[model samples]
Target chain A: MKKLLKYDYQYLKRTSKFIIFPVVIIILAVLSPLTARYLNEILAFSLGDQAGMFNFPDPVVFDSYVEYLSNLSDIYLYVIIFIGVGTFINDKTKGLYPLILSKPINRVKYLLSKYMTLSSLIFVSLMVGMLVFSFYTYYIFGEVDLLNVFLLSLLYFIYVELILAIAMFSAMYFKSYITAVMITFAGYILVSLINVFSFEFLKYMPGMISSNIIQVISNSASTPDVIYNVVVTLVITGLLVVLSITKFKKYDLN
Target chain B: MDAIKTVNLSKSYNNTLVLKQLNLNVKKGEVYGFIGKNGAGKTTTINLILSLILKDSGQVFINEEEIKFSDLAFKKLIGYVPDVPVFPSYMCAKDYLRFTLDIFDLGDSMVNQKTEEILEFVSLPNSTKKISSYSRGMKQRLAIAQALIHDPEIIIMDEPTSALDPIGRNDVMNIIYKLRGSKTIFYSTHILDDVERVCDRIGLLDDGNLIVQDTVDNIQKNFFSNKFYIETKNEPKFVLKKIAKINQVQNAVKENHGIVCYLEENTDENTLLKKLMEMDENIVEFRRVKTSLEDVFIRLTNEKTT
Candidate 1:
């Protein structure tokens, strides 16, 4: 398992995954705060004559957090879904499984290695993104809640985990990159749709993770509800991982 | 003990049986050529033996130990090279071999030395070109290199040279020849000529059934041993026609430069020779023909189909 981890790390490094991922997240981090800070002026400049017609409210540190969190849930999550599906399915599609599986490696560890490696990359990239967002937020807005940003990043990272889990499950189930990506997107949309339901149980679904992340940034969340959502998401992620491994074990690498 | 054994193994796809109850045994320290045509379940059998696919019925054994689908220990005893071996494109040959070593938990201090030594065995250059940039032949050499890195007791290859040029094929065949006595090689291929050159024993599979299994010499000797080639001064066509008239000649046909005759069972060669002299045909050369592996494969497969 440790050797597999080393190979996965080497894979990430040689494949430029080590650079592309963090660079993308850091770009989002820098752009989020910059966009949140200057949107009003930029928009006003665009509407020069009509600039006075609309009063633009001042952007706050909360808006920067909101921008960053929104980017994480939208763009960053899509990146995760696409890359995650590719990583999971490419081994099978590209004919890499027969060689790798022919070795004396456990199926469970083979799978977890990829998941853990990619998840670690995502975690580190999120942490780096948080630091960048906080620095920019402090420089521009003069106030940055480090703990809230940290918590928000951590919450968003958990959501990233769920997305990756769904991606892995979809890749294993569908075995086609496009189909896996489409299925993961469908799963994302289905979870979000469940979030709109009025049922009490629906509040703890994985979809509520995005809202919980926001509540953390704005300091308006119920601690118990947040805990419940995290627990339920973790449980679902675990189940999906189990399902992926089971399917892969039975899969014919012909 | 057999290095690899399959008993009553069967597989189906979409309700169509691709592999029937196949009983195959590959003995240790021998080159077993698994000869089959396309879609003859050769790869399927390999997959089942390696636990790469689920078998609908029966069991596989390696070194006398029954194998399960999830068995990893058995894998340590065997190495596999697929029909089309693929590697992580981002890695060079040394990197990929090192990764394979890591997979087997053989990441010792001699990893670099072992990698270089195996690479040299396959005749792969020691350059650091990424595997993605390699040609098909180069990838195949690298595949063999990686498979031998751990010095496994058994090596299973599926059509390793089916897609290579003559030179590449010869290179792979030479490597197999070099490893012949030291390792058990379960080589799967439709290339009968290579099998004739390298394999000690063979199992011919037709429609998933083990139709024939024996040593190369025994199979050839047992199959159509009475076939004789007669070259005469007369036209081959006329010779064939006259030969067909002989009672001892059960069948006669004109070949490229001679008349080939299949003598009836218990027919003496002297009887046929005397009758040929009676026809007043000047015989230039007359000798028993050695049946080739190709001839045996084609005739057997055709007979099975008919």
Candidate 2:
């Protein structure tokens, strides 16, 4: 495990992915809330008093949190997916796998190292972006609840883990990063299409978890609702990991 | 005990057989050269030995211990360098070596010491530049350093020098020569001249099986010929006629830049030389034609395919 860590840490140190992830997320983090707080000014600046064309609600602190979560779900999710897809595909294409597989490491240990490294980097990047946003959120709007923010961050972490697993699984399956990204997003679109039906099944889709999490943050959804979302996401993630490992073990590598 | 052995190993891809009941043996501390053409399953066999890919059947043993995919003990005994070794390209030479050394769990003291010795041994330049900036020859040298960092007993290399320029090829060959008795190397290549220069024994793989494995001398002797090669400034038609009339000479013909004379059974060199002197031809060079591994390789492979 330590050796795997050394290998991955060297990769993380040099990769532009780590740098890009945090910068993009930080921008989104600050922009979401700022956009929420100053929607009136932004509209008036661009449209004059004619911006009264739309029925805009008064800006509130809750509006900042809600808009931030919405931006995270809408835009930041695909960034995570694209980064996740490149993890294994690079190994295959670069002819590095034969050298690594030739070493004394087992398949499970190797795959685990890759998984942990990619996931942890994404996790750290998300936390750093959120921390920066928290400071700005407080500066702009008196004081936001730390406890509520912590719960929301935890929920977001769980959701990231799920999508990352999906992206990685697709990467392994297709053996191409671009194809993996396309398939992962395609899977997203397919599930979202299924989600549009008027049924009790809406809560089961992976995207619905974000809404449930935000509702939990806003004190509208029960803790049990959050648990249901967590349980389902974790279950799906567990299955994706198992599938990846099994397929990776059988991979020809050469 | 043999350093490496494979028994009836077989492999196929998508139902097309690539390796068929192949067997090989290399005694401890011997340089075993694996020679085969492209599409003759050289890389496939190497991959199976390292357990990079599963074999369809049969077993592999290193230093008498059988190999298993889950067991890393055998892996600890082996280091591999591919035809075109790929590095992180973002790391300097020292950083990349440090990563490989960490995998062996060596103490910091040993790591630092081996890093210096191995780098110096391969003769790579000490530099802070990233591997991405290194040329192909430089990368191959670093590949050797990484493979030897663990001090493994067996080193498997696939065409280590085939892609290098003459100077780089010489550098790689010199490194292999220096490691001769200390390490057992299973070198795979199609370059016969390299095998002639470095290998202690050779294996010829043709159509999914090992057609031959023996000492370099033995393979040459098995395919021995009585043909003699002569290169002279003398006229070719005159030399061919003068050589054809000798009682012991079977056939003589003009070759590119030389002449070939086949001696009759039990013919000796002195009797032929006397006739050559009597003919008074200007003999610039003369020697019994040596049967090269390349000849044996072509004959054996052609025979199998036909």
Candidate 3:
């Protein structure tokens, strides 16, 4: 396990471009909630006295949390997928994977190290972005419940893990980075398209399933449906991880 | 016991045979030269020994233990340098060494000492540049340094000097010569001169078979020709005609001021020299001609082709 860690650290240090893309996505994530608040304020000011006649509610902490969840689900998830796809594909094209395999390490450890590194990075970046947004919302709209914010952050981590599993599965299946990225993106699109059948069935699709759960957690929907979506997403993510590990063992590193 | 041995090893790719019933044995502390032309399956044989590819039949034994892909004991006993070294390109030399050490779980105290020693040995000391910035010669040197860091019992190199300039080739050959006694080396190359300079024994591969395997002296002796050259003080035409008329002499040709006489099998060189001496008292130099390795290689290959 220590050897695996050393190998993963070497890979992460050498491939800074892979890490830089995710950092850019995290920056966009931090800016998203603030941008939404500014746009809401601009519309209220432009309406002038008509805003009072319409009985409009001012932007609150809940609104900012909603914006954060939507941004992460739609945009940040794709960034995670793209980053995960490149992790294995780059090693294959450069002939570094076979060299690593020639060492004392086995196939399971190799794949597990990659999984742990990408997942850990994603978790850290998400936490940092959420911390920044939490501070921004507090300064702008006054104090909010800390417990609710922590629960929301935990839910976001689980959601990211699920999406990352799908991306890694794509990586293990394809030999080229471009092919892996395209297939993962297409899978996301296919899930989204299937969700358009009806609101109830759409909530069950893996891509939108997390967003629906987040919406229910923000006190916008029923609790029973939220629990069901969360359980189903977790189950699917577990199965995909097992499948990816098995496929990686059988793969020819040459 | 032999350091390495292969038994009836066979492999095929998409129904095309790459190796067919190949067998080889390399004794301990011997520099075995694997010689063949391009696409002669030298790299494929090395890959099989390293367990990078599966074999369709037979087995490879290293240090008397059967090679298993999952068991890394044999891997620790061997160091391999490919024809073209591939690195991450983003790493500096020091970091690359550290990473490799960490993978093998070497002690921290010895890592720096070993790294520095090998770097100096390969003449790449003070090389702190990233791999991407390294020249071809520099990269090849670094590859050698990495392969030797573990102090494996055997080093397998494929075309180590094929792409180098003359100076670079000499530098690499010098390093190999210096390390001869400390470790056994098995290198494959088409350059016969390099083999003659450094190898103690050689194996010639043709059509996926090891056609010849022996020491340099033994091979030369086995392919020896029964032709003798005689230098005479008299005109060479008279001696050539007289030698051709002898019953034991099959053919005689004029060569400069001498005449070369080809004798039948079982004809003694001493007897022929006595007969030539009796015929011509003006004979100056008389000795049997020796065959070179090039002749042996050509003869073996031609025999296989026909």
Candidate 4:
């Protein structure tokens, strides 16, 4: 276990992508509220007189936050996928796998270290981004609900971890970074397709939970929707993570 | 007791036998040279001993403990250097050493002192650059440094000197030779001269079997031709026939410039020289040539096939 931690720390320290990707996510997070504030102006300019054609009730700070979460969900998920794929590919391609295997570390501990490092990084970065978005939204809109933002960020954290699990699985299953990315994207597509089947159980698909979390934060649904999304997200995340760990254990490092 | 032993070790990849019923025993503190051709299962044998690859059948005992792949305690006793040593490209030499030390759970004081000592031993003490910038030889030296850092009882190197130039090879050889009495070094290489220079014993692998295993001197002595070269001004054919007639001479074959007489066992060297001189007083040169490790390897492998 100690060896695994040491190797994990070493890998995290050495890879620039690990540091850079999170910085990019944090930058996006910091800018999310600003982008939300300008959404009204940009929409007005682009639509000109047509902008009034689609009017609704007054948009609140929660609406700007909903926009932030949606944008982050769609784009930063891809960033998470990119960084996760890199973590595994770099080790395999750089010949570090053989060296690590030659050490006294076991395969289980090795894979666990990678999963934990990536998941922790993703969760921490997402939380920091959510905090920044929350602070900016409150500053610009003069009113913000801390409890709602915290709940939204927690739900998004689950979603990011689910994506991390999938990304890690893809990385372990395939040797090429491009292939792993394609597979992860394909998995996202599959989850989206499953949502279209209209089965109530399919609402619990890991990807849908993220969208539902955003919906809950926007107050677009009742208390039942938020509860269902949390439960489904936890269950799916648990299953996928367990599956990844099992597969990683038997994987031949060669 | 043997420091390392393998019994009937066999391994196959994709239905092709790479190592077949091989056996080896390396005594403690002995420099055992595993000599084989490029594809002759030297690496496979080493991998089996290191538990990097699962053996199809066999038991490997290290320090009298049966090695289990799941239990890495046995690994703490070994230091391994692969044909190509790999490290994280972003790590400076010092950090890399620290990382290794951390995994092995050594103390900070010991790690710092040992890292400096080993880096200087490999002549890389001042190299603060990331490992990716190191040359092949430098990487090899660093590999050796890391392998020795933990103070393992055995060091197993696979083709350690293959990528090295003469100077690098000599440097590595010198380091290995300096560890002569303290550590047991098991290295596999096709470089016969390096084996001759450092290895106390050698095992020659040919066609998936250990065709020869013995001390360097014993191998040379056992397979070496006991023929004495005799140069004489007189017609060598007459001397050959005369030598052939003697009971002490097994066979006398004529050469272009001289005659070579194979002596029987227990034949007195002084008596043979006296007889040869009496037969032809114009003898210019008479000497026995010793067989080299290469000659023994070739003879044993050739004998195995035919």
Candidate 5:
């Protein structure tokens, strides 16, 4: 398993994935806070005479956190899903399996390596993004809650991990990148839709993760609910990973 | 011990049986050439043996031990090269080899040495040109190099040279020739010339069935013992007509520069020669024809169809 992880890291490095994810995240990290800080001024400048008619609210440090979290949820997650599915499916698509699988590597370890590597990349990038966003928010808005921002990034990271598991499972199940990406997107939508239901059990589901991130940043989230959602999401993600490995063991690389 | 064995191995696609009851026993330290036409289940059998796909029913044994699906231990003892070898294009030749060695857990002590040695063995440059920049032939050689780096007991190659140019084919064949006695090679190819040159034994697979399997010499001697060829100074067309009338010649056909006759059982060779002499034929060449692997493959496949 350690050996597989070493090679998987090399794969990420060689493919420039190590650079792509963090750079994109950092750019988002910088842009998010800046966008939140200057939207009124930028909009007024663009609108010119028309800008006088509309009322613009004052920007706050919390708006910066919201902007960063929203980007993490929407754009960053989309990038993660797209690239994650490709990483899982490209070995077969590129005809690397017959040689790679013909080695002594275990199928489960082979998969877990990819999952762990990509998960680590996301973890590290989110950490970097969090620090950058917090720094920029403090510089512009005079005060930033580092702990709250940390918790927000942590919750968002957990949510991204769940999405990645879905991507891996879909890649193995469908074996086509386009289909896998679509299925992963559908999974994300299904979870979001489930969050809309007012059922008590649904509060602990993965769909509530996004809204929960907002609540965590705003400091109104129920600690027990967040803990329950994290545990349940992790369990479901683990199950999906197992399913992916199971499907991959029988995958036909013809 | 037989390095690789498959018994009653079978597979199907879309309910259509593509490989049926394939039982192969490739002995240790011998180059076994698996010859078949395109879509004749050659790749399918290799895939099943390597456990890359689920088999319908059968047993594959490596070094006499039975194998199961998702088995990794057996893979450690085997190296496989697909027909079209694809690598991670972002990596250079040495990078791929090092990765392969790392996958086998070959220690860091000799990694650089082994990587260099294998790259040199396959004639690939040790530079940093990514695999995407490699030509087809280079990729094929790199495939062999990776397969050999681990020093497995057997190497299963599925049509490694089917897509190469003449020079590339020769380069790969030479590598196989160099490793002939050192490793058990289960080579699959549609190129009969390569089999004739490199294989000690040959298996002719027709429509997923192992129709014929034996030493290349034995297969030829068994199937074409009665066949002989004669090249005449004449037009040869008239010679064929005359030879076809002879009772001892069961079948005679005009081939390039000659007439190929399949003699009747127990017929004396001199009878056909004496009859040709009586026809005032100027025979420039006349002898028993050494049948090629191509001939045997064609005859076996045709015989099965008929």
Candidate 6:
């Protein structure tokens, strides 16, 4: 297990993807609220004093965080996909698979170490990014709703885990990182975009749960909707993990 | 008991067969050299023994235990070094060795002690560069270190010197010498000279068959020609043909510049010379030479030997 973890750490540290992940998020976190606060000024710089033609209400810290979190669809999703798809597939290309699997250890244990290490890194980045974002948001626009933030963060965590599971399984099964990312992206878009704000029946989806996160942070989401989404996310992630392990057992891994 | 044995082991890819009923034995405390051309099922056979690939038919035994391919428990009995080894690019040599020891479940003190010993054995005890920055030779040495970390009974190497430069090859050859009699090494390579330099017994794998297997000296004696090279003023073909009719003479062949007469084991050279003198008066020179392993390999793989 110790050797496995050491390898896992090596994977997470490779290519400095972890650094890139948090750096991008940190930059986005600070920029989101800054954009919200200086919307008129930013617009004025672009439009050359034509900004005076339009007026709006003052920016709120909560709205800025919402926008920051909303970027989950574009920035965070892409970064995490980059992280997920290459963990194992790239090693296959570089001729490390045979050396590793040739050992006496079980392949599942090795795969789990990769999975857990990546998950932990992603978790740490998200938590640390949230902390920094919270501090900035509070300082710039007074205090944030700590309880609401906690609840919404939980929902987003499940949502991310679901995406991560898809990304990882696709990489393992397809054996191509690019194809894995493409498939995971296609799945994410299909699930997250279909009747996004208008669908009531399919709100139990992991994607739908993420979309409903605004309501959760705003303290307006119903308890049952939250419960159903969380349950479904866990179930889907669980199923994907089991499927991965099953395929791994018989995988040629050549 | 033999340290390694395979009974009628065979494998195929798609509809094409690669290894066909390969029965091999490697005794303990000896270096068994496995020689074959590229794509001659050397790697495939090694893969089967390591249980990295499932075989179509046959059984593999390590230290007399039947191998269960689906489970990797059998791997505990062997250590393997691939032709080109790679490691976690993020780690330096010391850390990588430590990690290897950990994988084999060594305790902390043992890990440290073994790591130090293995690194020292590989002559890279203080290398601080990440594996990614290492040269091919360095990686190969580190590979040797990692393979020895587990102290396995059988050490399987696939062309350990095939990919190294002259200096690197010498380094690895020296390492093999150091391991002589200390471990049972089943090494595969196309470098016949390396085999001759270190291996005690050799198994020639040709077209997936154990074409020839024996001790070095025995194989040479069994497959190679023990022929006298004779030069004469006139054409020696007629005299060689006469010599070929003798009961003690195995066969005779005409070379470009001389006649080569294969003699039976008990036939004396002076006796053959006297018989040749009686057959031909123009004999000018007579000599005998021992054939090399390369000649034997070529003869065994390409044609039936006398």
Best by TM-score, which number?
1
Task: Give per-model TM-scores.
Answer: 0.97, 0.91, 0.85, 0.88, 0.94, 0.89
TM-score of 2: 0.91
- Candidate 4 ranges with C-alpha deviation above 4 Å: A47-59, A220-243, A251-253, B227-230, B234-282
Write one digit per residue (lDDT tens) for candidate 5, span B43-136: 9999888888889998999999999987788888888888888898888888888888888878689999998888898888899999898999
lDDT at residue A48 of model 3 (Cα atoms): 85
Best of the candidates, lDDT: 1
CAPRI verdict on model 1?
high
Off by over 4 Å in 1: B233-235, B247-250, B255-257, B265-268, B277-284
Q: How close to the true structure is residue B305 of candidate 2, measured as C-alpha lDDT? A: 76
DockQ of candidate 6 is 0.55
Which segments of model 6 are wrong by more than 4 Å? A44-57, A195-201, B231-275, B281-288, B304-306
CAPRI accuracy category, model 6: medium
If both were scored by TM-score, which would come out higher, candidate 4 or candidate 5?
A: 5
List ranges where model 5 is wrong by over 4 Å: A43-55, B230-238, B254-258, B265-286
lDDT of 6 by residue, A1-254 (tens): 66787767865676687587678777876776676677756777788767678775677766876877777557887888877777756776677766777777787787777778777777777776777777777777787766666665667777777777887688778866678889989878876785456666677877777657887777788888889978988899988877887777776644
Model 3 residue A163 lDDT? 68
Alpha carbon lDDT of residue B163, candidate 3?
92
Model 4 lDDT tens row, B228-302: 888777787877778787778876789877887767656757878888777655878788867677766776777
Arranged by TM-score, best first: 1, 5, 2, 6, 4, 3
Local distance difference test values of all predictions, in order = 0.90, 0.82, 0.76, 0.79, 0.89, 0.79
lDDT ranking, best first = 1, 5, 2, 6, 4, 3
Among all windows of ten consecutive residues in candidate 6 chain B, which has the lowest summed lDDT?
B297-306
Predictions' DockQ, in order: 0.84, 0.65, 0.43, 0.46, 0.76, 0.55
